[model samples]
Target: MAKKPEDKVLAQNKKANHDYFIEETIEAGIVLQGTEIKSIRNAKVQLKDAFIRIRNNEAWISNMHISPYEQGNRFNHDPLRSRKLLLHKKQISTLIGETKRDGYTIVPLKMYLKNGFAKVLIGVGKGKKEYDKRDVLKKKEAKRDMDRAFKERNQ
Candidate 1:
């Protein structure tokens, strides 16, 4: 058996994990302009403050900032343009239904290249409350402490 090639990650939204409880995740293709793809290939993209929205039965990603390609000049794409997501009709319908519920949202977790095309990992997530964020932080701290103690004992 042969191992599969790993995806080349372009950008990731690290804050998404802290702000949302991801219930499910799905990979979807993105429509990019010429310069946009070039910028992405150079790993000049940002997923912070980016989110997915279902409108008219279609999925769109907004607020994702892809820096303009240095050589693109006047043909550079917009940094914060809304990009269409390619998902099956069934997947779109399911997302629509799930997002109708209170506190549920569609968020972009990461962007990566698969094969030769750009793909985004979107998640169905529920908003985290203040207390929930605090709880997660506390647990992370506890885990870090335990790992440190274990390392010391082993040493």
Candidate 2:
């Protein structure tokens, strides 16, 4: 199957995949201030340490950093404020259920612009143990070796 083209990706949490097994991903709209949107469009956002949290029956993205717009002046928004995420009620309920499980949490996988709006791809992930990470690395190395051998044979 052909992979779909990605939207204009603004930021990604590379460590999310390394530290957790992402079970499911959901795209949700973000509520951004004027300067925040400008900053996002400039690709000055960071999702490295961002995570999703459910509070008062609403989903919020905490610790996501969107740098202040260069010319924003006094109207610039905070870089580290918790931003609200827009999701359907049923989706929020499901996420709440999933996160209640031990070691399971909501993580922001990527942030992107879709149709001039900022959208966040959040995932339900379970934390990986040290052994699990090592096993994954070993499997990846084996796959790389196999692919290299196949290329040599074809050559």
Candidate 3:
């Protein structure tokens, strides 16, 4: 069987996993300018500190940094700008309803190129308390220890 081509990931917000308890995730298209797409194709994008917001039934991503293309000249796009996210009306409505709940927000988990189009994987997340963050770290440490022990035993 032929191997399937994998989607190219441009960037990921690793902190999103640490700061939020993600309940659900969905892929959405992003609107990009000409220079923006050129920059994305070169893998010059950052998802750190980026978040999604719903306003007037439209979803927008804020704080996303797509570096300007080196050769873009005067047409270079802004590095940090709010970008529109494309989703179905139903999805937008659902996201709006969910975001209205206390402590619930939308976060972008990853950015990737699918079939030559830039897409974002967004998640519905709730803020985590400090204690919760510590607990997660503890669990990760335990898991790592177990994995190491198991590997030694198998060896």
Candidate 4:
């Protein structure tokens, strides 16, 4: 197998996990202009508060902010405009079918440069309830307490 290119992951939507349960992930190519690609390469992209929606049998990502290139003059793409995601026919069909269910959504989890091109990792997720969030918090706190207790006991 070929090696994956080394890219500095610019941004991630970590809160997506805390707020929703990720069921599946798919990497999709993004349609970007020249300056938008340059801005992403410089780690100036925001994946937070971004989401994907299927419409007219295609998926569109909205609210992802790719900053304008510092040197670009009158050719900069809009920072928060919707961007199209390229996915295979089968994947799009499957996503459309599954997302039709209740509480399922398409969320952009991360953005990274792949083979010198921009790629977005989209996740199929179900939103978590308030009780679920509290449970996760309680589990995290318990794990931390356990780690501290073990260290104290060892010392």
Estimate, for each residue in 61-90, the C-alpha lDDT of model 3 and write its tens digit: 999999999999999988898999999998
> Each model's TM-score?
0.94, 0.95, 0.94, 0.92
Considering every candidate listed, which one attains the maximal lDDT?
Answer: 1
Across 58-119, the per-residue lDDT of candidate 1 in tens digits comes to: 99999999999999999998899999999999999989988999999999988999888998
- Candidate 4 per-residue lDDT, tens place, 22-110, comes to 88888889998769988888899998899998989899999998899999989998999999999998999999988999999989887
| lDDT value, residue 70 of candidate 1 | 99
Candidate 1 regions off by >4 Å? 1-5
lDDT of 4: 0.88
Looking at candidate 3, the ten consecutive residues that score lowest on lDDT are: 1-10
lDDT of model number 2: 0.90
lDDT of 2 by residue, 1-155 (tens): 11222787888899999999988888899998879988899999999989888999999999999999999999998899999999999999999999999999999988888778888888899999999999999999999999999999999
Model 3 residue runs over 4 Å out of place are 1-6
Q: Name the best candidate (by TM-score).
A: 2
Candidate 4 lDDT at 97 equals: 86
